[model samples]
Target: MDQDDSETCQMCPMDEWPNREKTRCLPKLQEFLSYKEDKMASFFCFLVILCCVITCFTLKKFILYWDTPLVKANNRTLSFTVLVSLLLSFLCVFFFLGRPLDITCMLRQTLFGIFFSLAISSLIAKSMMVCIAFKATKPSSSWKKWTGVTLPYSIVVVCSSVQVLICVSWLSTYPPYQGFDMTTYPGKIIIQCNEGSDIWFYSMLGYLGFLAAVSFVLAFMVRTLPDSYNEAKYITFSMLVFCSVWIAMIPAYLSTRGKYMVAVEIFAILTSCAGILSCIFLPKLYILLIKPYLNTRKHVFSWVRK
Candidate 1:
């Protein structure tokens, strides 16, 4: 008998396996979307990070101009929070890259869900604030008391808190874990995270969608109001873009497998975030920077009158 035939190869850890000759080891199939291997994922990661940094600069600019009448028209604090959450949402795509460890697997989806929920909730709160403001000016309207930061802040907190609870329950019950998918590709092993429950994942998405739908409806209803006093038109367009991206995402997300699935999601995240940022803030930014004259109360009133 050959000496090599009788001796067993050393046991490999979960990430590696014995080579064909049994004298050395090779890395087992790495399933996660890796920046080192996949150029697409790497490109996306860089793009999202760049967008996040730009958003941060915009955030600082927004803060500097906080006292402007245009910024003061709605809840600035909530707006800031939404921008922060969108930044986080963009950054969260990193978790889906590299190898799928247990902790990263668990966090990638949950954090994405949570951060997006916070952003959507903030949008809904802002839309609601607009509605309340319009209502408060009417005769004997009790909504006058609810016209302050209190209601918008509460809406953000309460809506986001519910999503937090949902994620917690999902994690405690069926946490995601690293898994090998051997059957998807012929003669190749695929490494991926097995999301513990599809139901939980979809539920998280559904909740985010629900909040977005509410915001879209409310903002659309108020879109005809004076654009000077209310940002409902911009909000409506932003929500429309946000909803369209995710709605298109669902079928594509369901249809793709392996790394493409993750890519679809990452793309959706960046697109929706960019949509919100551009649709809602770019016009205001243009007014603030390039056409500063238009930001004045006098210009606003005159435009409205015309």
Candidate 2:
């Protein structure tokens, strides 16, 4: 045999076998690529959710801070932090839009990140609020009127800023055209942030999961309180909706494949809609505008919107 043939036989490891490598690595790469594509797609739905989450929590906090008995008399540290963090969260979405990457992708990640921050902030604030509310009526009496929003958004903001910065630096370090793309399928190349492993994505899932869990536990506690406490019920119900929405995301995340994961994001928009409609606004409207119906009850056919 020739010297070249000998070298080829000796150097070829099992993984480097020509056709065999194609069989194993190619399929695995395709699955991963599909996953990446789905991640990108899901980003769209995530943006709408981010808007909803931020708008609901931040605006209501502003209103609540102005006059709610929940934060009766404590330091405004949490309140101010949540407020400022929310503002920054919204700004993050806006500035993220101007990134050179595909606007659609930027929109998705920005929205997702903001939504995440708000979710965390809401959980922290709600848990504290619930605890304070319960404790206020008890022995210590120190928590009277001390309702503070849990400014978890601050940590989320810093973490998200770093994540975005990492992604931006990775993308800008080289022009898109010159980037190394893994060709996973025929005529298809995987475009990923590649800051590291998919840890960022999983971190999101983990954080969101933690927030949802806190919301669920506190909501359970709130519901068990006296029915005379109607305000508690409303907040609890809203939290229930938020928690459920985040919980439902687990399956979508698992089943998603690249570019298709956007469907999961779209789902977020619908959930956010439900959260706003059923949780916060509907209850308040019922209390404010429709409560009069309780005294002079009347019925009418609903009018259809054109």
Candidate 3:
């Protein structure tokens, strides 16, 4: 008996990919930073949670020692702002872990941008406060007026507001949305958020870098101030770390594709935030908890006289 002749195979639809055996068209494997499937995603989740828990613990310690010289000297209000914004920044990482959706796409970058701006704004405010405090020590210094709470709060509000405005414009003009990339990898589709406007995206990041640079400069200027009011040294170092992480992230983020690109950003967020938290708070926490004597006004005054 004669066997039936083979027929030409038809092309699979764009949404579907062919199996290895070419026996049938199968749904494309959706690629994303999946919390359940990807080990990197799970690790990121663990880090985000760990960072957030540490932030909360630090916040508690600050609140408990709110009246101490160390806390007050650092500007408790600004310290609280930094912690809260940092907590929010860590939470923002969650938006990047799962499958990309419209809401997550809109929130991940903008929310992170705004939160980071808030944190940096607080840092700059702290740095400026140190400068003003130092200048006010001089006879007939006009910086006396800026030593009040108004100037620092104003700095935070104004600096953070600029980032908010940029994010608003980005969302209104061209909001990011979930998109798929079928050609990047054969037999798989990359599910990612399309950054609607590269200009706006980079602008948000650029503004963050600018704020960090300004903070670093201001803090460095007063870093040599007496230890009594020398949180500026910590701020300078933290900004240096923050700037370095993002500067390195840009190239790595650009060079990678799909889920790894997202991983790069998530790693940057965690590392930069950790840098700020550790550089700024660890010393204060040590004083508050381990060396209560150093947290006293007497010790501060002694440092001032030196």
Candidate 4:
């Protein structure tokens, strides 16, 4: 065809582009979650960073009071592990904030699922540890031998390994990639990550929820155990918050499209993780930093009697 008979394409305005006919323009694909283009992404990035800083402060406190009876009573190793996982989970939000590149799309859900699994698994292990501690206090109880860090560490490892395997299978079977949905909205393109398989995504979430539910039930049953330093009560509340946020998130996430959907998942991640961090650890931090006397063995025993 002659040059005049052929078509030419030129760059359109921001968030718009020429249609196939090239005579008119339509809304462009909203591809990126950049700070300049979307303030919501920027806001979430700030939140993630803030939460990370808080996690650091919490870790510092835990290390400083590592020798205290209150800190010792709660398995310190498990505590540190849980804190680190929570921090990683918060940092994972950064993946959701940026553009949905090939690598980010592939790793975001996998890492998020793994980190959350680790956190929930740690909570479950801690709850089991609390139960073991109380049972072992009984004279001649066989649970005494299992009341060490070994069980909790094993629980974290086994639970996390399962998630790792699931993610590996998901990536191996149908890995996610940068996708564009051109028909979702009229005359507009929605750029997002195609999460490959719904089964794998929901399966990961289901498994994490199962761990949380078990943790909640165990912690609730043991919350009344006679120890002022007990963590069962805190675990119960944290699991409640964690389960509630994700449960509500599923429908909201499915109802939205494009960037809003991403926003919903990010919101769920931040809120659920923050719930675990604040509920499980803040009370201990209060005692460790603000009221050191309450962290002593004498105070624990005294409160147990009252």
Q: Tens digits of per-residue lDDT for model 2 on 1-306?
A: 113334444332322223332332222232222323445434543654566575566546445544432232222344444444434443343322212245444344545555445544544554456556666766669887463333434544554455455445534453222122444344334443322324555554455555556655656666555432323455466556656776687688668543334345445545643563445334433443455343121211111110
Per-residue alpha-carbon lDDT of candidate 1 for residues 13-89, written as tens digits (9 for 90 to 100): 55556666765656666556887888987799788878888789779878988988777666788789888998999
TM-score: the better of candidates 1 and 2: 1
lDDT of 1 at 82: 83
lDDT for each residue of candidate 3 in 11-115, tens digit (9 for 90 to 100): 889989877667778888889998789999989989999999999999999999988878888699999999999999999999999999999999999999999
Model 4 segments beyond 4 Å from truth? Answer: 1-22, 25-31, 302-306
**Candidate lDDT values, in order:** 0.82, 0.45, 0.92, 0.86
Query: What's the number of clashes in each of the models?
Result: 1, 19, 0, 0
Distance from true location, Cα of 120 in model 3, Å: 0.5
Winner by lDDT = 3
lDDT for model 4: 0.86
Error of 2 at 240 (Å): 4.5
Flag regions of model 3 displaced more than 4 Å. 1-7
lDDT of 2: 0.45
Give the candidate order by descending TM-score.
Answer: 3, 4, 1, 2
